[model samples]
Target: MLNIGVIGAGRMGLNHSRNLRQLDTIKLAGVYDILPEKATAYANEFGAKIYQSPEELINAKDIGLIIITSPTYCHIEALRIALDAHKPIFCEKPLCRTQEELDELIPLITNYDNFFALGFVRRYSPNFAKMKEVVDSGELGKLLCGEIRCLHGRYVRMHGDWFADYDKCGGVMLDMLAHHVDLQNHLIGEAESIYAQSFMLNQNEDELPFDYVSATARFKNGFISNIQCSWLRNAPSDTEMTICGDKASITFSDSKGLLLTKGGKTEKIPVDEAALNIHKIQGGMYAEEMAYIVDAVINGKKPLAGAKEAIDAMTFCFGMMTSAETGELVKF
Candidate 1:
């Protein structure tokens, strides 16, 4: 069995533990968090051990894989510790707060023959994957444009002060929209140029961070795309994407499943029963991603989403943040 150690017993971390418990091929060896109670809670519930420190978890002889769901700031050091041990790592997205950190860590990763996968769960969504296949197969007939709209109630402010801080979370663009940026790259291509606008509606003037953002970009493949993200909405949470092509259009909504429009006719694409089962939980993608990493480590295969793809997506996100601030098109 693949022994997995999870660092951070917070919401995402605990979810990982639960999923790992359900996978027969994997074992939840241990977990660690700065908060003793948090770690203890997960360990007791999952029947795994709790370590006093991240170092202990990393140095554990039985832990072949380390899943880092710690805060964004801790990602660099946490990943470094795992890399030094030559342990395979599956890190959460927005890898770090700055490009310089990624610059320093990229070399360390290149030096070791280790498996690394970033958590871009949307890529694992079967509906999105099938949409990509359709677009790539010429079935969609040369993608013309796409738009992704994601809106969630402003529960983030309730989490903590750090979440509302732009420097920490990189605002709505980096923290939330980064997923769509990665998805866009996965489906369309690298963005050539981007323009963005952002605001802080219903927030105090002293907030010093944006709560909503909308960006438009031109892709290298000659496709134009628009992305809208907001944490200020008071309505039911909704996320939807529409991709238009020469021959057809594909639409996906988090609430509704998938739909296809072609030749003046619209039809619902029947949801895959297996994929639906996988999408039932937040941990589904996490488990599948870890499984992919395990395969790569054991079989000498490449990860579904490698570091290069992650870096490209982050670059696009950072560029959008810059564009929003400068009111000008930023080119990659």
Candidate 2:
């Protein structure tokens, strides 16, 4: 069994631990967090060792792999520590929140000796996979412009949480839209330029923090995408994406499976949700993702989403933020 240590005992950390346990070849070696008290539940539930610090957990002899699920701001330091130890890593998305972190991280990630995977879990989702298959099959002919819509309710985890802080979370664009941005890059093509606008991450005293952003991207492969994401009050959480081509168009949703359209006729493509997500847990994509990373560690193979994709996705999303801030289009 491959022993995995985790940093950050927050929701994502615990979520990954639970899913890692579902795989027989994986062991929950240990976990660490700045707040030791927050990690007791993880230690007790998984019988994982409670580590004193991130340095300790990552450097443990028993840990063959490290998974960083820490908050966005905290990711860079832990990532560096893991790299120094030469351990294979599986870090959750939005690899780093700012330009400085990216500058320092890019060189290390590219030169790391061991496999490094980023958690763009949506890549492993069934509906999105089916969408890619149809798009690549050429039944859609020449791919054209597309649109991605990601909407969410206001930030509910408010009680002075880091997520409410724009500096820490990078708002909805960096935190939530990274997933769809990666999908757009993976399914569509490389983005050549982007123009975007947003609320600039403003919040009133004692009010829940919220943000909304819309970005238009022109791809190098001669296609365009309108990407929108939001965290607003009284809004129902939903995600939808559609890509149109000369022959047909395909649309997919987190809750609605997939659809194919041609000549004014639409067809629903069947997806095996239960079979695809056997664990049937929340963020079910993480289950397959955890297992895949373990295999990559064992075989010395690259993950479907690795350092290159992580950096590329972050570049595209961050460019959108820069455009929103400067009121200008960002070109790659």
Candidate 3:
């Protein structure tokens, strides 16, 4: 069994821990968070030990993999500890707020002979994976254009002081757009230029300006894509994408599930057999992602979403933020 150590007990960290618990091929060796109670709670629930410090978890000989779900600011240091300990790592999105941080981690990444997978869970979702298959099989014909819209309500209770700070979370664009951009890059390829518009609609003394963000991207492959994300929408969390092609069109929705409308007819694609399992026990995308990471490590194969893919997505997001600030299109 692959010995795993989790380094946070926040929402994302808790989700990953639950998924890891379901897998028989892996064991949750320990968990560490700045809050001792949080770490201890997760450890006891999972029947795993709780380490007093991150360094202790990283240095443990039994931990074959380190999962970093800590706050965005602490990611670099957590990753550094894991690298120094010569352990494989699986990190959450927005690797770092700045390029320099990523650059510094590159040498360590190259030197460590272990697996590293970034969390871009959309790539592992069955609906999106099928869309990719259709595109690759030439069933979609020439990919002329694509559109992605991701909207969700911000958990007011969940947005604590640290997450509310723009400097730490990099605002809504970095924290949320990274997922859509990663999915776009995964399905439609790299973008050549980006034109974006963003704003802070709802603000209070207790919260930061991370309520809404939007961007339109022009891909190098002559396809155009748009993405919208929000933390203030009252709608029931809509996430849908449509890829328009010469022959047909493909679309899917997280709210209504997979959909295909083409040839003057619309049909709901049958949900994958794995979907029930994914939704029931594993909590949808998170479970799929955990399985993908385990397979990547054991098979010595690259994951559907990796560091380079994440970087491409983040580069576009950074450019979008720049565009929003300067009122100009940014070219990659």
Candidate 4:
């Protein structure tokens, strides 16, 4: 078994632990969190040991891989430890909070060929994978332009909540929109230029903060995408992406299966709804993502969303944030 050590016993860490149990080849070896109760609870429930610190987990002889599901602020330190130990890593994304961290991180990992995967869960979702396959297979013909819309209900949190802090979570752009940004880059190409704007909609003393942003990006492959995302106080959560090509168009949603429009007709492309629903309820795309990483490490195959891809996706996101603040188009 490929024993995996997890840092952070929060929701994401819990999800990863559960999914790791479901895999026959992977074992949840140990867990660590700043909150002793949290780590103890997860270890007890999952039948794993509780580590005294992240250093212990990373250095554990049984752990062949380390999953960093810790908070954003702690990701860098955990990753540093894992890299230094030469352990394979699976880190939840927006890999690091700022470009300076990225600068320090990129050089550190470039010379090492250890297995490192980031959590861009959408890449593992079957529906989005199908969409990517169609777009890349040329079945949709030459890519023209695309649009992505992501929305979430304002989860109420206090001022001290890390999610509400722009510096910690990087607001919706880094926290939420990073998914679509990665998807956009995955489907089209690297962003060559970007223009973006945002409105900090609701800021109340009693309730959590919220933001809405819209960005336009031109890819080096000559495709353009208009992306919008929001953290709202009174709205249903939904996400949609439509990629238009010269011959046809492909659109998908979390609730709806893929839809292909061609020759004046549209049809739903079939997907395994029952299996997808089970994965969603269990760990959603995260479960699938973990499985893929496990398989990669076992078989010596490279992961699709490695450190470079993670950096590229975050680079695009930071560019958008810079554009939003400066009110100028930022270049990749």
Output the number of the TM-score-best candidate.
Answer: 2
Q: Where is the poorest 10-residue window by lDDT in model 1?
A: 200-209
lDDT of 4 by residue, 1-332 (tens): 99989999998998878887888887788999999999889988888889998999899999998999888867999988899999998899889887788888987776766888888888877788788888888989999899988988755756777777777877777888878888878888778999989863344666668888899999998998998888878887889999999999999877677999999998998866554444333567777777778889999988878877888888998898888879999998
Pick out the ten consecutive residues of candidate 4 with the lowest summed lDDT.
273-282
Q: How much does candidate 4 score in TM-score?
A: 0.92
TM-score of 1: 0.89
lDDT of 3 at 39: 88
lDDT over C-alpha atoms for residue 114 of model 1? 79
lDDT of 1 at 169: 69
Off by over 4 Å in 3: 106-112, 154-160, 200-210, 233-236, 275-282
TM per candidate: 0.89, 0.94, 0.88, 0.92
**lDDT, candidate 3, at 18:** 82
Q: Tens digits of per-residue lDDT for model 3 on 21-55?
A: 78878988889999988887887888778998899
RMSD of each: 2.9, 1.9, 2.8, 2.5
**Alpha-carbon lDDT, every model:** 0.78, 0.85, 0.78, 0.84
Leading candidate by lDDT: 2
RMSD of 1: 2.9
Residue runs of model 4 more than 4 Å from their true location after superposition: 200-207, 272-284
- For candidate 2, the per-residue lDDT at 115 reads 86
Regions of candidate 1 where Cα sits further than 4 Å from its true position:
110-112, 154-156, 200-210, 276-287, 294-299
1-332 per-residue lDDT for model 2 (tens digits): 89989898888898888777877778998989888787888888888998998898899999998999999999999998999999989999889989788888889998888889999988888888878888889999999889898998655756368887778888888998888888888887788999999875665666667789988999999998988888888888888999999999999876676988899998899987765665444456778777667777887888989888988899997898899889999999
lDDT of 3 at 62: 88
